[model samples]
Target: MTIELLAPAAAEAPTRFVERHGRRIAYRETGSGTPLILCLRFRGVLDSWDPAFLDALAAEFRVITFDYSGLGQSGGAASYRAEVMARDAIDLADALGIESFAVGGWSLGGMAAQVVTAMVPERVTHLVLIGTTPPGRVEHPSEAAFLEHALKPVNDLADEEILFFEPASASSRAAAAASNARIAARSADRSPPIAPETYLALLQDRHAEDLFPDAGGYRDFLANCGIPILVIAGDHEIVFPTPNWFALNRVWKSLHLMVLPQMGHGPQHQAPEFVADLIKSFVRTRQRADVAA
Candidate 1:
């Protein structure tokens, strides 16, 4: 059976703002309830969202998403530090009049989410991290493995199966490809093209030595956080091993982990129902906590 992926669906007008650093950050939102910002993965934009995923969450909470500095429609040097990226997220929240809210992110965006939550612990009501890890991994993927399968240039990835969303069946694969192709087609120009210079600059400019907060700090922050957390990752996730998240949960007072099968780098895409359900469950837990408090 062919799964028909609906369009982007009706959404509120997207807003653009220049972060304090003068980098323009573009964001958009939908629905109306608790503020919920959906931070995206590396090399992604607002248009890359999975419509079905958006539809489910947008119905329950005020959904937020943005293009980060140096990517998508946000114009800046391709070299913004994670601190700057985290600040952009906080600034974006301020722009949207969101004082406190739940935060969720994937991959690089997931790392940024940690920074955002730590930077403004008071403003973040709950936290969700997916397919990410703290900086300078103690168990980083092998260089040989990266060379053999992961680090190829973007243009060279056409035939490689998307590690993020592994299509379990031919039908599912077709559906997933169609969805990505549609988004790719629509944002052909808007999606940030890989800039060798920009990518290199970000790689070279590492002055923000503390840009990615260390795992020790991540543990402390989550342990002391007054909110609940839902840490979701793919069972087959190769980006950051499950043990990393296990280490994080060990530090948290109230954090749970969900490892989904038939998934990888992007749970929001490959397991949208699971992701959406997790959000709903977390929101309910937060509400209960508030009532108890």
Candidate 2:
């Protein structure tokens, strides 16, 4: 059976749904190769991803993006906790009959990706973490402005610059504008923005524990998992500092880190094609080595 590939552009891909454990999970897919499931950041929906980034990645792999259960277009009980969110990704993959695939996440979604990798390391071929921190201890904390802008009911370009881009750099600011415009291009059949109340409750619950907790031996699992992991980050990430990932250098067996200069949290948005190319190289390179072994 030939599966239809959706348009690579985030604006053009049609949303699809699947039943998983009594919940209807919403997802979108493009390209055709090894399946790649991407988890979203805080308050992110399927539309939050930059179209250019998705388009570029579609050239090399089957890219899948989805909303967490009960959030965005999905239907079920919503939980922002990493474990619950991780299950959503795994369940969606299972529902789609994907046996082995790569997993990528951004910010909050990155945390969930780590959980997913830990839970089923045998099935995950590779792990890509973008603009997010690692488990256990962190070297640097997030900026105060991040939460301030993130919690707002509506975010203008200025707010987005502070939240996702490097407002101090003129080039980064330009990228922010372009990314926002691409995100806005999907005007029809768009997923609704996450409600403020839901996000606010998430924040309240998060305060009770560490952002990236070492629960269930996460750090040890990551350190020994042997999965080819790629971490992409900006030099000056305000939300999750790049230094946090650096703090764990050489700790994981097969971890590769790429820090983009003069960028912020959303490096993929700032350099969509570049990031996609990097990902393609990373995944293919590791897969070749695995086959040779």
Candidate 3:
């Protein structure tokens, strides 16, 4: 069966739903290649993804972006726990008949992607984490201001700039505006925003132990997991500082890290095409190395 691939643009891709585990998962896909399932960040719905970033990724990958179960257009009980969210991602893949694929996530979504990789290492071909912290202890924690803006029901351009980009850098601020405009292009069929109360509940539930009960186990898995892992961050990231990943530099043999200068949490948004090219190169190079082995 030949499936038509949608154009690699946020405004062009149509929102679709699939039933899995008695719940409907909302998703959109573009391009055609190895399936890349992307999880959403904290307080982010399907519409929250930057259009430029998604379009750039779709150029090389069959990028699949989706709202978590119970969030946005999905139908289910809402829960932001990483482990539960990991199950949601796996279920989506199963429903789509995708046996193996690359998994990518940003911020909170990155946490879920890690859990997914750990849960089914054999099925995950690659792991891409953006602006997220690794499991266990964080060397440099997020700034308190992040919660102030992130928990808000509606984030204006200023809030977005503070949350994702480095307001201190004029170029970063300009990039944020451009990214916002691209995201706003998708005016129709957009998923609803997450409520403030729901996001608050997420923060409350994120106890230290609950977030990472067995940091040692997860670190060990990441160290030994043969799957190629890519970590992208901004040098000025306030939310999940880049130093946290640097702290684990020698721990993982297959781990690759890229830090964008003068940017913040959302490096992909600041330099969508460049980030996409890096990902394509990373995946291609690693896959070729594996085949050679």
- The C-alpha lDDT values of all candidates are 0.65, 0.89, 0.86
Worst 10 residues of 2 by lDDT: 284-293
Candidate achieving the largest lDDT: 2
The TM-score obtained by model 2 is: 0.95
Q: In TM-score terms, which candidate is top? A: 2
Residue range 131-185, candidate 1, lDDT tens digits: 7765544444522332344434463323223556553545446546655654554
Candidate 3 local lDDT, residue 77: 82
Candidate 2, residues 1-293, lDDT tens digits: the string is: 99974555667889999998999999999888889999999999999999899889999889999999989999998888889999999999999999999999999999999999999888999999999988877768889999888889999999989888889999999999999999998878889998999988876776644678787788877876778889999988999999887757777767899999989989999999999999999999885123211
Evaluate model 3: give its TM-score: 0.94
User: Candidate 2's error at 157, in angstroms?
Assistant: 0.6
**lDDT for model 2, on a 0 to 1 scale?**
0.89
Superposed model 3: Cα runs more than 4 Å off = 1-8, 209-216, 288-293
